[model samples]
Target: MNVFYEEDGGFKVGAVLADNTTSLQVEAPHGKRSKIKAGTVLLKFEKPALSEFMEQAQHVADELDADFLWECSNQDEFGFADLGLEYFGHAPSTVEAAGLLIKLHGSPMHFYKKGKGHYKAAPEESLKAALASVERKRLQALQQAEYTAQLTGFSCPEALLPQINMLLYRPDKNTIEYKALEQACHDTGLTPPKLLEKCGAIPSSHDYHFNAFLFEHFPKGIEFGEIGEFDIPQDLPESNVSAFSIDDATTTEIDDAFSLIHLPNGNWQVGIHIAAPALGFGPGSRLDEIALERLSTVYMPGNKITMLPDALVNAYTLEATKSCPALSMYLEIESADYSVVSSVTRIERVKIAANLRHDTLEPLFNEDTLARGGPDYPFKKELGILWELANRLEIGRGKQGSNIGTDYSFVVKDDRIAITDRKRGNPIDKVVSELMIYVNSRWAKMLSEKGVAGVFRSQFNGKVRLSTTPGKHIGLGVDQYAWASSPLRRSMDLLNQRQLIALVRGEPAPYASNSEVLLGAVSDFELASEAYNSFQRNMERYWCLRYVLQEGINEASATVLKENLIRLDTLPLVTRVPSMPELPPGTQVQVALSNVELLDLAFGCEFKHRIELQ
Candidate 1:
């Protein structure tokens, strides 16, 4: 047979190449004696390279349903040259035809239907089946559109498109659809109960799936912008506390909120307002079960899927008002050393008069206006007291051998996230943070000492490997430390909270809770943290790439930190010293960000190439 040897020296047989090149023809030994023309049939690669290899290759081509020619030889050195072969009534140059053959041959030849070529795999019948399925789906959707149009008396295809899309795209899940159905019924004044009854009693459907369904019914009326703004109804029956916020952007259901009270006892009474998620998302619902599966809320940059719904989270369960039940941890400590001379942990109700963030209050500190307002006097006074307490406590902890983790802060400027090394730490922020840490640490220790079954949240002391005895908590600068602060985080904290609650209530601890489960939970937490770090690092790389292309200089002082990672001083704000590489310590380099595929060894992340200068 005429064979065309590829660059890799693989043979392809055809009378007239797919590219209509006669010079690139593959003809059989028998066909060489006969006058072979364009469109001549030949055997494909069928046999393995070891036995009748050409025939095996022909068999593969036959499997792809390719029309192969026999013994049609090419004149080119690579046996890929095309002869004068007519293709679709147009005869192109032999070289051009050969080039085209090479192009088709080199491309994913396996993508074509089987019996075509060895590279051209898979059965043609399977492809036809896949196409038929798509066609059937399209036809079914068209029929549904027609039916829907008739019922609604809508003639426009634009109007019908949404309905058809939803019928075909809506998920099989029921609960999500139930929620959407309820929303649609409320919005369109349709009978939701009757409609739900007509459909099998499905409990939940995914939000996107249900939304797609609604889009089908009222494509024009459905506002896409409003779909993302998932606000729960506030008119629902009030519980002990209600969700109140001026804007949707700032409102998030978090475990804790802090309010400051200037107490006569000298130390400020800082109220930690945490949403009781366990109360609403307890035992039964599929959501609760899923929450148990995941354990905590993980905030990835591009996405945030909350553990609890806004209803329980932002509303009923969170500590919003003075009457909301809370467990107050009051510490009467010296503001100079952050030493807790006296402390009281009480289970009671509290009011968070102000829910503030560092960003929100930081500007106010600059203006000195918050302290001027009489209503904000208490907040200001408490903030002052808290800051003093926090600094002293922070110092005291350091003295006690606690490793304070590195703080990497950043800000969103002009839609791009920029890393900032600004010393933005405020006394007020520190005060609240330190107070919480102190209380959380104390509770963790209390539970651990009491031999209670609870989860421990501690960082390993720079040790790479997992071992029986993990060294000091380096970040905390402590010989050992754990957390029991944020119960709303995951069941780990919840378990710890329950233990602390039992201790406070003078009840015996439930020792039946498995240690294995706690360890498993710890392992999960580590995995989740790693995932978060990976996501953040990826975004950082993207931003750094953009910076290099737009603002960064071509020649930046770089130090090869690791084998592949080279740390470049891109911004003047960065205070950390350069990392040492195996090569000459601080080797200057003219580096550009080149897209490099992340290897399995390097983790599934793209690397920023650093070209070192000699």
Candidate 2:
């Protein structure tokens, strides 16, 4: 006897070896033997042969109309053979019964299985909804294929234009657009950004990186909307010294300046003046809230996002010829040794003598000029004395003031980049850095002594961190350091300035020691500041690549830092050459650059030859 049975959710035909009444031992057409339950057998037939039975039944099953079968059936559950008999107008033959069973089993949308060999016609509404869903999926599959084809052909689909940033930065993998992009990326063996760039989806690589950062950090926008008027302090006492600021030409937030007075007793009274934005607004105010949210000014290659509004920065910036409100730290130093005899902190307005720029000032006030000592410039006498005092301060800190490396500055104008390198630890750097360090350390000490709370920057065991508790900064060689110098650029500095002002006036500090608010601000500032700095570094790298392309640089010199890592000599670019041979660190070599991918901010390089040192 031949039997058609449901096994493992599929239909099969087998010839019976033995019938035990409850179970049958059968051999399949291919000679494989198996035992199946009697209840699973849908039909028994002795046809032309077992081998030909399945193919014939499948053909018949394919020829049957599933909709006609469903329409002929009643809503109640019934056996397939009974439905076949009803449709055929007589008892069904074995072949017809088997074909009907196969058709019913396959057409699940038309009929739902109730038990072995039993089924019920699906409800009209449910069946229609299921068919519609299947059709929709089929259409979506076709659309996805079309999108994939377009992307593979270096063309972006119109549907994916609005979602380009999300697809590149943070993709929702479940969406069909993302799926198509993923498929295209895999097919081309390229990253999403590179593939998109090839498709002309990314118009500007610079804007690509910039927009990605803004999308993450400043999602709403970079606009400072409708800031209310805030009072600028005008009642402060004016100091008896003419102060001057030294900064970059592009700088608009002039936070710190310097002054000098020759005392009649052969002592020099030096003044370190910091712009006092804290006096215009207090903690928990609207401006303070805005500053706290931004945390710090975000700097990139050619631009910056200021933490404070332009109006507030202009009102408090130490501009030339303006007596701006300041937090001044006066040091009475003995002229013979350049050592501080007494130091005092006061709030006053200091007359601005000038705003000196580095490009113009460095040529005249550098190491060689100081040695010759004849070229006269504005505030040259004060700067010369301050430079001497800075050297003495460096010696007092037990620092040798050796040059560390080169510092690169990027200037971008009209989409062109100019990268210039300045030697670290130069005379101008030492003077500004030492004086800022002195003021920060002294202010931290004063806050600690007066039992006031403030934010401090500390380094120990090669790790640097911010905290409310005062601690030594081993990196700066300071006893205790707080960033109280740039109130217009940093939120933490503004907070510390508020505390310092309160201490100077004998008023209550804005934040209490060990307060959750203070601790939370420290943690948030650390995270935001690090994020800002990382973005800055990435932008700098982007500009470095742009500079390479702009200057038509193909071959360049680099100093090897590790096995394959090297730092470019002309620009602040560090990259790896996979083809490079094993060389010691600090070995100079020439490398050939190729395949610069801006969207990914990377390049390919080949090792050329080693550069011998002179």
Candidate 3:
């Protein structure tokens, strides 16, 4: 082997004949470009050392004297023993053969003089084992990644997200219908809270149940109410409103009713009919006790568990079909100001006609169809008088700023919730409500004037104190007042009815001195019942979220009427909607959704991701 000539400095410097393969021209990067030079200190053939095979073989080639031919087959291992051919400028055939042999051996090798060298493992076997170990580690890591992805219920139900979007429904007001909620306990191996937490990530029935549980368990305070059942027709006049089947034995208990009449003085008279339930339920009866315990009805779409039983609310003591037991109070309304001008109390039997619900009656008064519909339609001649009277009362009430807030209604169909905001006041319903308010207000005033103890119906005024309005009939735009109606459904009404009985009989009123204490209890019960209903509504929403909003695009607008939360108008058409924050007020955004879990109910088919701004 001969030293190569070089023109680029270092090593053998000088050109060699063209036939000398050890010398050659090469180009190298000098700042931004490359320059060519001859005799670039090229090498002939040189063997890579043991250390070089383990790390940088190219570095060893650079320091060699011969032209180092870097040849590698498909196999990764090469050995020094592969350098068997003598180099004489060009040796393609022999060099290629040696390279093939090294690849076949499949191992790195180190060679030393037999008598003076050290001992080492066979390069092929050692290197093969090392590579296999590396591969095994890589495979284990990949398997772990897959396993981690599949685990779903530790903190989130990623695994269940795909199934929740299609199984939920809303059956009634503020209620969710997930037929699978009970079954989830078995397979999920979790308590209600745990299940809710995991399913919160997707759509699941547990979402609603658990969210309600959370709020109920941690309420700021608690309130309680006593239950009562009253006759609707006996205490009020009939509006001739053929709404629901008032004669049906299954549901036609007279709890409330109303009538409007024209007085000789050219003023209108509004009458409210009420059944006295407190007369029978008493204070310690089984139904009374249960009513006290339950405090309110738990109304779901398919099922309803009343706070009182049919024995008390429907059958016994109910003023139905011209039958009445004992009456408490009669309220008279003066058309001049739509005011309760006079009220009288006595024990009297009242007549009954028909019972009605808003749903059945709304159709007859529908904005679309009227008297032209058919024969069975109840919107007849005399009924028009009642409607006219109701309209007058409502108009007068509105001008006075009565707190008759706008309301929304829903009809559940096809396991979905259909919402409607077009429920303008039903004449019959309004007449009934207004007449009852008049009667109750009269009774409340009578009790206050008589210095007797009785229950009062009250609502907190939207003021800084959040306290029940101090004697203001704000909802009716009247002076300080309270309500005492539907004794069977409300303990306060029962107490008032009982007090009215004593007062009418000229008997001394009960607790005339400490009436304030009794008033406190009544207020507490009313407030507690209201809180309970509010809680139930929130719980139902949680269920809807899990079942409808977890996996779809949700387009909605919301308003914050109260300080607590914003109400979104998204349920009727969209299911599995995304959260509202991403699509802030007045600004809309496209989203990809998977599931929604708010307050406990799971909803939606998929989670949503924002796609574009609108």
Candidate 4:
């Protein structure tokens, strides 16, 4: 006998092979045998063949209107056979019962299944809401298909334009737009940024990379909000000597300056004057909070986000002709050997006599010019004296002060980039670096000696870190180096300056021994400083690639660092050449450049020939 049964939420017709009261062994129309419960068997028939039963039943189910069937049923639960009998106005045929069951099971919005074959009509309101949801989903599917087509066709829909950054940076996976973009990316074998760029959604590659960084790091935006002003300190004593600053022309946050005074005992009193923003605001102040949040000034090739507001930077930066409040460290050096005889730290306002720029000063103050000692310029004598003292300080620290390699500086103007290289350990660099290192080391030693907590930059076993505890910075050849010089640029410097100020004033230290605040600042500053430096490096790399493209150069010179890895000679760019032949490290080579992808910050290159050293 043929039996119509419900299995796995569907109706099927099978021929019974062995019949049991509780369960039956039946062979389906496809000749597949399965064991079924007797309760799951909804109907028993004999006339129609098993193959013909389901097809005919499905036709009948399709012909029936589910809404009409729902309307005909009562609110109380009833079996499908009973409903079919009531609707057909007769003892229902097996096919009619199976078809009605099929319709009732399929149209869940109209009727909800209760038991094996029993069903109940859905409530009016619930059925309407369910139907509306289905319709909305259907429409959304169509819209998603449309967006997918547009994206795959290299056209961005207007709806997706406003959300381009969001889609690229932080995507909501559940949205249809994101799903469409995801599908398009999969179809085109491209990333979200590449696909968006293809669709004309990305106007500038530079902005794309820059904006992604901003989105991740500065989610609230780079602009400083309504931090109420604080008064600049006015009661500080002014220093007797005039100070001069040497920095790049682009520098506006003039952190550290220098002063020279000839003392009576044939000695020189050299002052390392640091711009003291800590004087204007103390711990827990609004400005302090701002500085702590930013941690350090974020620098790129052509731009920077200052740690403090422009107004505060202006008030504190030791600009030329301004008597800026400074945390000055004075070292009395005996003229015979340029050795420090005594050292003292004080809070004073120092007159900035000049802001010497590297571009102007390097021409007159470099190694060759200093050795010749003929071409004289403003502050040349002071710079010479400082150079001598810097040498003495370097020698005292047991450092040979070797020039490792070239340091590249990038200047961007009107979408054009100029990458210039300066040899490391130049006299200007040595003087500034040595003095800053000395001052930082001195302040850190003072803080440690006074039992005050401060953030220090320490290096041990080739690893560098920030800590409240004092340790040796083997790289700088210093016992303990706290960043107390660039108070206008770094949060650690500012915090260290505060501790040093309190210690020098004989007042209670703002951060006590093992203070959580100091420790937390060290941890937080390390993380932020690394992130800022990485961003700076990436932006520098971006501009290096920009400079290459801007100059329309095809062939370039490179020094191989490892197998297939090369650094460009003219710019600070490092890339791999897959087509390059195996070569040793430091081998110079000529390479042909092609396919520069700014979005990916990558390029394709082929090695041409080895360049022999002169």
Query: Per-prediction TM-score, please?
Result: 0.49, 0.92, 0.51, 0.96
Candidate 4 C-alpha lDDT tens digits along 1-614: 98988888788888999998899999987789999999988899995777888777888899999878888998999988888888999977888777788888889999988998888999989988998999999999999999999999999999999899899999999999999999999999999999999999998998998898889889999999987777788898989989999999899999999999889988999999999888898888888889888888999988998999999999999999999999999999989999899999999999999999999888889999988885869988889999999999998888875545799888889988888999989999999999988999998899888778888789999999888889999988889988899999988898888888888899888887578777777888878877888888888888877877888879999999998999988778889999898999989999998888899988888899999888
lDDT of each: 0.44, 0.91, 0.44, 0.89
383-403, model 1: which lDDT tens digit per residue?
555655666777767743243
**Segments in model 2 whose C-alpha atoms lie over 4 Å from true places:** 18-24, 35-39, 64-82, 85-88, 91-111, 120-125, 226-229
- Number of the candidate with higher lDDT, 1 or 4: 4
Candidate with top TM-score is 4
Q: Work out how many backbone clashes candidate 1 has.
A: 69
Best candidate (score: lDDT)? 2
lDDT of 3 by residue, 1-614 (tens): 22122233222211222432533432221222222233333333233322222123233333333212222221333333334233223443323333322232223332211211111233445555666876786775554344333333343334334433223222222212122233344456654444544556434444345334334432331232433443333443333311211211223335654445566786655445566665564455655565555554554332334556665665433343545544534435455554556655556544454454466656665434444643355434335545555556556556332434445443445545544454334455555565566566666676677776665444447421212223555556544445455565555555567677677778775545355535454555657567666655654554345334433345444343233223444442233233534334333333333345453344443223333434
Candidate 1 overall lDDT versus native: 0.44
Residue ranges of candidate 1 with Cα displaced over 4 Å:
1-251, 262-273, 281-288, 316-323, 335-338, 364-378, 399-421, 424-429, 459-461, 464-474, 508-516, 543-565, 568-614
| TM-score: model 3 vs. ground truth | 0.51
Give lDDT tens digits, candidate 2, residues 1-614: 99989999999989999999999999999999999999888788887599998888888899999999989999999988789889889897877788888899999999999998899999999999989998998998899999999999999999999999899888999888999999999999988988998999999999899999998999888999976668787789989999999998889999999999989998999999999999998877889888988989999988999999999999999999999999999999989989889999999999998999988998988888999985898888988999999998888877766546788888889999988998888778888989998999999999988889989899999999999988988888888999999999998899999999999898888899987767988999989988999999999999998888888889999999999999988888899899999999999999998877787789888999999988
Q: Model 3 off-target regions past 4 Å? A: 1-254, 260-270, 284-287, 298-300, 316-322, 326-346, 366-376, 379-383, 394-406, 410-429, 457-470, 511-520, 523-527, 542-566, 570-594, 602-614
Ranking by TM-score: 4, 2, 3, 1
Model 2 poorest ten-residue lDDT run: 396-405
Question: How close to the true structure is residue 117 of candidate 2, measured as C-alpha lDDT?
Answer: 84
